[model samples]
Target: MEILSTPQGDFELSRFPIRSKETLRAWDAADEYLIKVLHEEQLLTSDSNVLILNDSFGALSCSFSATRPVVVSDSFIAYQGLLENLQRNNIDQNNIEFRDSLREYGEVDQPYNLVLLKITKSLAQLEDQLHRIRPHIDKNTRIIASGMVKGIHNSTLQLFESIIGTTTTSLARKKARLIFSQFNPELTPPQNSYPKTYTLESTDYKILNHANVFSRERLDIGTRFLIENLPVSDHYQDIVDLGCGNGIVGLMAASANPAATINFVDESYMAVASAKENFTKAFPDREANFYATDCLKGILPSSCDLILNNPPFHQQNAIGDFIAVQMFKESFIALKPGGELWVIGNRHLGYHVKLKRLFGNCITVASNKKFVILKAIKN
Candidate 1:
């Protein structure tokens, strides 16, 4: 990634996942456009107190490190990227503060003079952020949001107006646009609509979901297929739920295999938190491990007898199999010899082919019109 030339200072940026020679740049034109708007509006200063929301990486934070900005984001990888990128440039670590969006840290002790916003893929998440930050904004606070023109939509602007009041837009530059919103005294603070729960007809308990988890409202079709066809065996002891969203897979695994210990891992703090809540609600006395991680990257190899996965094909706005392929590779590396890796995916994704390539053998456990449940055994 190129060094970002901002009014505060030029700083380097990197993507969260840390892929080498990656074609995608960490920060996009929206980031640069936001900086330009800030400079034009004379908002950047040493005395300015800044709160940066949803900075994909550390671009905005690093650029404004002098003002000691507070950075709040949802992805654990985004938090890691902030630290790594700050270290990459040898910037003073004391200049920035970090917080996860899953936590109740939106209410600030002191009001911020300037807020830089980068709209994320989840409008639910954006609404939640706006709802939380409503009390913190005043007449003097400047809230400016920027994103790719493709990302900004009519509803996006409508959200700004509904929450922050009297929102407006800027001319497109380099395929990016800015939204300027001012505080409205009349609009009521938005209510929190997330952490919703829905019951599963197949199960006795309901699953909880935070705003941004995949298919938060209900069971996804892929996982739904996996559940109806989940293999039952007494041979497994240690089990893992890779990319466990609300931990339905691991919970079901636990119920089926009473003697086994189950581990649930996901990158989102909210997902892990939701999984933990659901696990406790479903089986309070049952022992389980919930981890927030980037796949099974740091998990000890050959430590599990079975791994169940419904890996995501997308990371933010970009859709591809990079993450799912990486998850498959990680599962292969982490499973014990002769251990089973079970997966549920869309048939068109060709996950069976990739699993066969990595695990040496793949079996179609079940299938439907749109999804296929496949299993692979470690060689």
Candidate 2:
């Protein structure tokens, strides 16, 4: 396991759901660079309520948890990593504030003096987040956003100026650069009209997405397979669509099992938004529970009867099974006695072993050459 050592402490991080041969750890050079700059200038203090944006892993927040930092990120996997990493390193979570990007508008009541922004591939969505953050910004609020050199495009700088303030770039260290910006008191950013819509003919519904939803333009193939191979569960009282991107699996589940109450959960604000819209369009009369969460972290234990997942294999550029494993563990914890979890995944990923370990029983419900639908029954 690769440990990311920072000035604050050493963090042993991995891509969620552990992997046998994964090459990437949770922290990156950008994280190190960000921490370096923060320490170099003493930007972090005990009283500072730092809002960390887009921390891919808990690298930034975990190191600064002692400072009572509030972590705000758009990635479910990243949020998951933060919690697991905090646990893995034995860091008390009393000071941490985990805020999902989708529900960021909800946290406007809490004011933060300093914010740490880490730019990702979703720059367009980042712009919207910044705009929403305008009302929350004050004169003393300083933002330091960083990313790998490749992630820092000209438009990234332009978007910072458009939404936050004047920007300056730090020299690249290990191919990562930081964008330092001060809030512009004169500029007031407008509200973003998100939940972008796209219609799907197969399900015959129009999906709404917040900016961070995956494959917002069209459906992903893994989800299509899961929807096609959905199981008929007579005993399922409460069902959850884990990583319910765009709400496709959960929507299909609700359509098939109208009697069951479906809970749709995702980390992305856009994903939750899209799922809500799709649910309304697909089953307008039904009221379903939808949440933008970091995996199943906040879900009540031993509550759900069934969980459906099309687990993601990567968080950003790093490819691994850490996330899927975490989801499996969470599902097991959240499931009632004898409850079941259904999942569809690329066969190459071999999710069966993880399921077997967590649930004590694993079976191949259905399979194609490239993909397999696996089921785990909680014992």
The sequence of per-residue lDDT tens digits that candidate 2 reaches over residues 74-137 is 7666767777888988988777877767655425656667888888887667777787666666
- Itemize residue pairs with steric clashes in candidate 2: 16-322, 16-323, 17-322, 17-323, 102-269, 208-274, 210-270
User: Which residue runs does candidate 2 get wrong by more than 4 Å?
Assistant: 1-4, 9-22, 75-77, 87-91, 104-111, 188-193, 202-204, 220-240, 260-273, 280-311, 320-379
Q: Judged by lDDT against the true structure, how good is candidate 1?
A: 0.85
Error of 1 at 261 (Å): 1.6
For residues 1-379, could you state the per-residue lDDT of candidate 1 as single tens digits? 6677777777777787777767787788999999887878788787987889888778888887888988888787787888889998888888988877766544555777888889988888888888766777788889989999998999998888888899999999999999999998788755678888899766678888888777888888888878777767888888999998888888888888888889999988888888899999988888899888889967899988999999887886657888999988988889999889998888898999899988878999888899888999998
The root-mean-square deviation over C-alpha atoms between each candidate and the true structure, in angstroms, is: 1.6, 5.0
